[model samples]
Target: MGNAGRNAVVLVVTKVADATADLVIEQLNARRIPIVRLDPGDFPTSVAVNAYLGNHGLSGSLRTPSRIADLRGIRSVYWRRPSPYSVADDMRPQDAHWCADQARYGLGGLLGALPDAHYVNHPWRNRDAEHKPAQLAVAARCGLDVPPTLVTNDAERARWFARECGPVVYKPVRNTDYHGDDSRALTVWVEEVAPSEIDTEVGRTAHLFQQRVDKVADIRLTAVGDQLFAVRIDGAPGLDWRRDYDALSYTLIETPPEVAKAVRAYLDAFGLVFGAFDFGLDRHGRWWMYECNPNGQWAWFPDPITERITAALADRLQSPGNAHAR
Candidate 1:
């Protein structure tokens, strides 16, 4: 290995108590890789960064309580789930906003500009793949089977689609947490809807209505680099498999070659090295793509799947050139 490769470090961006990050970091540690794990939520306070333009390119140091990471020496960055930056409560609202912007564009921007550093999946690319409509379109374009989807804000159109499509499902454009009357947080679950349920209120905002696929099982495919780990999830009949994790049973299975090819193609289209794809496996043995989460959760999965994913990620971080080769 060259000097740069010898001195390279792996930067992990994630919040505390993230089991997924913990596993990956554990693997990296076993491989004797230098790592700097920092949560940006403590930025401008506990976490400090100083970057400057130099002859080599963007160079900086990220300082936390225990250690400091040399920005220039970062070969691969695992952009896992990091909490949002928090500002001082005593600061004015406007001042806090300004400070947050600086932290984002300044420190965040410098990290984004690192030379030859591979981000597992770039943050901007992650944001782009998060769009359900865009993901459907891309999956379809990649020759993956996708269910008919309609995004509209017109009640008449929604009703027409619902009537034409035998069984349609209503899903939020983006899942969000809402407080109930009792101040308890609740998440909106995907539910099958009828034509009669279409109301004028749907016209108030854009909504997603898709023809529900007659699926016997759900598939969760976690892609790390070019490798895809598929798990067949069998559970109670429901519009959303995520409604109850406890009710689900998982089995590791090989992904069909054609579908796997489409998955790799979809990742290329999104410029992502990693993605978590959900699919509906129909009773007729057809697989239909739903969406891909660029920064999705994978640790809770069972058996060899989680272990395989953790190793794949650690390998990618340990050898980033393989990611580009894929």
Candidate 2:
């Protein structure tokens, strides 16, 4: 383990108890690669940063109780999910706000600028790819079949669009979990809708409506670097399979050649090396693109798929160039 390059560390920025990250870190440990696990939420108290511009280049180090990472020596970063920054509650409101701002722009900016570091999916790219409209447009351009979609805030427009598209479905433009006034978490599910069902309230905010595909099964294609895992999800029947996770089953499958090509092109368009794509396999055997999650979760998947993904990510992190596998 000592022979592993100390100058090249894989910086994993995710919160504690992230099972997926924990698995990947363990794999890296087995490979004897240096890793620095960080949770940005612990910035002031547990995480320390000392970054600056020097003669050689951007120079600094991040120090935690367990490990220290030289900013310049960071070979890659697994920018996994992390909690938001925080400040002490005892501080005055204004001072707390000011300190949080400094931490965000100061520490966040420097970390974001790590020299020659490879990001699983760069933060900026992840933000850009998260937009559904952008994703659909790019998928269509890549020769992928996307359902007729409309995003609008006008009730009349939505009604007319639904009428033209036939059996259309409404989905949240963003997957945001809400809480009801009763202090209970609320989840929105995709549901088929008719033109008459769209009310005037649709004009209040933007909504996404797409023609529902007559899908026989759902496919989740998780792309890690150059490796693509195609899993056919069955058992649950409805507008949204996600609503009934316990009822779902998974099977490892291969993506059609054309779909595989388009997946690569779609990722290339967004400058992303990782993306979780959803496709509906129509009864006619055609796959229709639903959406892509740039930072989507895939660890819940069972067995060999999880192990394969962990190995792929660890291999990518260990590679010096931080370039895409393919």
lDDT of each: 0.87, 0.87
Off by over 4 Å in 1: 1-3
- Evaluated at residue 106, the lDDT of candidate 2 is 87
Per-residue lDDT of candidate 1, residues 1-326 (tens digit):
22157878888988997888999999999999989898888887898888878675676688988878777688888898888878899999999999889888877777677777888878778888899999999999998999999999999999999999859999898877799999999988888899999999997888999999999999999998778899999985687878788999999999999998999999999999999998999999999988888999999898577999999999998988755643
Score every model by TM-score.
0.96, 0.94
Which residue ranges in model 2 land beyond 4 Å of their true spot? Answer: 1-7, 320-326
**lDDT digits (tens) for residues 1-326 of candidate 2:** 11134658899988897998999999999989888999888988899998779677788789987998877788888888877788998999999999999998888788778877878877778888999999999999998999999999999999999989879999999988799999899988899999999999998888999999989999999998667999999987687999889999999998889989999999889988889999999889899999999988889999688999888888888884654532
Error of 1 at 217 (Å): 0.5
Assess the local accuracy of residue 41 in candidate 1 as a C-alpha lDDT between 0 and 100.
Answer: 85
* lDDT (Cα) of model 2: 0.87
Find the 10 residues in a row with the least total lDDT in model 1: 1-10
